[model samples]
Target: MTGIKMAAAVCVALFLIMPTIAIKNHDVTEELSDVPFISAADAAHMQEYVAFDTREKDAYQKEHVQDALSVPPAECSECLFDALDIYREMNILVYGADDAATADAVELLLKNGFERVWG
Candidate 1:
């Protein structure tokens, strides 16, 4: 009877925890689902690279990659292209809240003939 009770308790605990695990996994999967992310270690190793923070001006001013350009996602594509025209030959790495921002910036850069763009 003791052994049976222990087994039943373990089973109940597993059942209770399984859904939480699944929910956490789903949330993790949704984050960065469409964006290409370079690991921090890998990013640190990039040679002659420029990092751009694509969040809002306030968020960027608060905290951003060291020496990163504050390129707000709300900027026009033409303006972005013009601002980054000089860096066309360099590696450009962008980061923001999500696809609507950072990923879109990456896409705009690529469309405007900026090579070596990433998020």
Candidate 2:
């Protein structure tokens, strides 16, 4: 009886929590869908774009797109906002070591009212 009750309680908790988790995850995906991914060639064709670098300081210093401003990672929200706030009106091209890193930076930029952002 005790084991059955425990199993039932666990099932009930998961049933309630799973939908909430799924909804939250889905919303995050939907929110990011609006931010487009531009190829390096496409970005180069643009007359002007603010290159936003989400790579580590060392990686950025070693090699990055010309004129890319090092904004580091999205974990530092305040730093990203402070560095990028002035360029809100400009088109931004974000690049990082991986897709996940770039997406996180792009998401942060979009949430902060940066309308023209690409990864």
Candidate 3:
């Protein structure tokens, strides 16, 4: 039984590690040159901007930036677009639970012609 458990653990570990090993590392600086991702500090310095909290409502309710609007893109996209339409001309700053989530929201906004979208 111990040997079987050990073997199962090893297989699980290998399964998780394989994808990371197979993927190629990207140069973040080069990739971000044209991207609108900005540091939190830089975002703070900006005077006029509408910050969108892309996390779930529960997360937003727990804790979020002052005046940040909760618009979870994955949950209700129609509402997200509607909200975007209202603030189309404003500088939009998006943040989520993870980098991928934030990136996806920013990309969606950009595709929909929302300028000045930052992740």
For each candidate in the order shown, give its overall lDDT on alpha carbons. Answer: 0.59, 0.62, 0.63
Candidate 3, residues 1-119, lDDT tens digits: the string is: 35344334333432332222111225344433445676544544555677787888998898766567888876647666876687889878777776566667788888888988987
Residue-by-residue lDDT tens digits, candidate 1, 1-119: 35344334333432332222221134434543544544443444555677677778887777655566878767755876787788889977676765446557777677788778766
Report the number of the highest-lDDT candidate. Answer: 3
Residues 17-101, candidate 2: write the lDDT tens digits.
2222221234446544555666543444565567677889987788655456888874457775886678988888776776567
- Which 10 consecutive positions of candidate 2 have the poorest summed lDDT? 15-24
* Distance from true location, Cα of 66 in model 2, Å: 1.5
Q: Candidate 2 at residue 49, lDDT?
A: 61
**TM-score to true structure, per model:** 0.64, 0.65, 0.67
Q: After superposition, how far is residue 118 of candidate 1 from its true place, in Å?
A: 1.2
Rank candidates, TM-score, best first: 3, 2, 1
**Candidate 1 error regions (>4 Å):** 1-36
